[model samples]
Every structure is written in C-alpha cells, then in structure tokens.
Target: MLPVAAQQNLPVATAQTQNIKRIPLQRFEVPGTAYETVIGIAEIGPNVSIGRHTHPGPESGYVIEGGFELLVEGEPPRMLKAGESYKISPHTIHDAKTGADGAKVIATYVVEKGQPLAAAVK
Candidate 1:
C-alpha cells in the first residue's frame, strides 16, 4: 500500500484519489466480439484536472452535472456542459478539467477484454 501522502496525489482515476471518484457500474462482454463494455460514473471535484489518458478502444460519455473542458491532442478544447455527450476514438489521448462547480459524468467504453481500462499519456 502507498503511504497516505502518496495516495493523496495519485492520478484522478487511479485506484482512488482526491477530487475524483470513479464508480464502476458494469462490465460485460460484447456478443461475438473480443471486446467488453464498461460503464462508470466520474465525479470530479471543483477545479480538478484529470490528465491525458487513453483506452484500448473507444470511450463515450454524457455530462450528468456541471461541465468540464475536454482537451484532446491536436484539437481545440471543448467545454461540455450538462446534458451534452461526447466520444473519443480508440487510443486518442484526452483529458478533462472541471470548472469551479466541478462535474459528474457517466462514461461508456468499448475496449478489448483484459486490457487496462485507461493508460496515462506522457
């Protein structure tokens, strides 16, 4: 186990961390495919920033409350407000930073089974 101080600085979605709560809702295998679908809710505290990362496949999400700035490599940042939805292609590096009100989002990912759900990008 990591020391309390180190744990406190972990990446937003890594194991667990301050300012962000990731709740895994479900994971199921896709019929006739080698991929699986994962659903979860990400609650980000005010001013929290989730660094760039990527999944083995695609990730789609809906803003459930408040909003954030979605930054993807080579693209302009997009502000996703409540009630909006967005999708990122496989392995596309991206990150999100919440505004003062923070944000809550439900995300769905279609990824290869047995692979890490997310990987931080340099």
Candidate 2:
C-alpha cells in the first residue's frame, strides 16, 4: 500500500471538476531488482481531462465504467469505453479525458523503486 502522502501526491487533471481517486490495491517488489508493480483503481469525473504526464515505467488499465479519450505521443487519439483496456510504455507522455458519463479504471504499473509514479508534463 502506498502511504497517504504518496497517494496525495499523485497528479490529477487540471480542471477543478476533474479529480483522480486512487485506491492502491497491491504492490510487489522484484527480487534483486529496483522494480515494483503497483495496482490501483482510478475514478475520473465527468468531462475531465487528466493533464499530460509521464510515468516512471509502463502502465496498463482497463476501463471499468464509462469511457475515456486517450492520447499518447505519436499515436492517434483513441476512445476507450467500459471493458476496454490500454497500455502505456515507460516514460511515454500521455493524457486522458473522461467522456460525458465519467469513467473508472483499474490500472497497474511496473515502476522503479523509490521513484514517483507519475510526473506532470508541460
């Protein structure tokens, strides 16, 4: 489980209406390695746009409710609805916006030990 401070430090969409609720589920450290896998669920508000950001490692998520518009650098923007899933490569700058009905997703990340999960991008 991530500490409260760490969870609070996670970035959220810029809009006041936008917010991210991260429910840390599990974490596993790789033996003899500096990598750790973290799992969590994220709830995004309706019509919210999570600001552009990059992760310290790869991330994957499955939409559990509603839909989202996802844009990753160098790739065409795409829409993912409930039951759909997406993967983001390490350090890939990306952004997401919830659809009219908002969205919820279960996300898992394989990240470096002692590194912040995400960093905002300009």
Candidate 3:
C-alpha cells in the first residue's frame, strides 16, 4: 500500500471519488509449510468502503497512505492512518471505510494454499 502523503503529491481530484482497487503484487509458497503468502496493495477511493469480508487466514497489513475507519465485527470501529500496521485473525469479518481522500494499504496473507484469499460476509 502507498501512503496518503504520496497522494498529496498528485493533482487535485474532481468532486467524484474513485472506487476500490485490489492489485496483487506477489505470491509465493512457504517452503515446509501448508501455507502460501500473498501480498497486495488495496487502493481505496475517497468516500468509498470495501464491504464486510473475511480472509481465509490471518492478514497482516500496513497503512501506507491516507486514512480509514476499520470496522471489525463485534469491535468498535477505529481510525487508522499512514505508518500504522494491523493484524486480523483468520475468518474475522471486517469492513474498511475511507474519508473524502481515501486510503492505500499493503497487506500480506498467510493462507492455506489453493483456498481463495478472501470471502464476502453477509
């Protein structure tokens, strides 16, 4: 994930905000283990939200840019900004919401091989 400070360097945007984009960066199998590692960047457009979802395994993430409110099921929502990192347990449902400017995050998942990275929550 890129940081919001980096976004400030870009040209100003129009009134309308952009949508969330998930760009996979890399993936590799963990030798001697049943897990694989997947790394990707999530570009959350301003005023947008990624609906509630759950990972096949644990998720380790870093906020590189902008800011967002993380709504983890059964927990109070919290605001996270650049330079911060977070961990989500396997199968925990959660959602991410952004302010007017949006946020960028880089995340890594250590999941069972051949399983989908994430599943949508009802």
Best by TM-score: 2
Judged by whole-model lDDT over C-alpha atoms, candidate 1 comes out at 0.77
Residue pairs of candidate 3 with colliding backbone atoms: 1-105, 1-106, 3-64, 3-65, 4-65, 4-66
On a 0 to 1 TM-score scale, where does candidate 2 land against the true structure? 0.88
The ten-residue window of minimal lDDT in model 3 covers 2-11
Q: What's each prediction's TM-score?
A: 0.86, 0.88, 0.82
Candidate that beats the other on TM-score, 2 or 3, i.e. the better one? 2
Stretches of candidate 2 above 4 Å error?
A: 1-5, 13-18
| TM-score of predicted structure 3 | 0.82
Quote the RMSD, in angstroms, for model 3. Answer: 7.6
- Summarize candidate 2's per-residue lDDT along 22-113 as a digit string, tens digits: 67688889789999888888777788888788888998999999999999999999999999999999999998988779888988888889
lDDT of 3 by residue, 1-122 (tens): 31232222222223322475567687889999999887878788888767677777898899999999988998999999999988889989887888987888998888898776777666
lDDT-best of 2 and 3? 2
Give the CA lDDT, 0 to 100, for residue 97 in model 3: 83
Report the poorest 10 consecutive residues by lDDT, candidate 1. 1-10
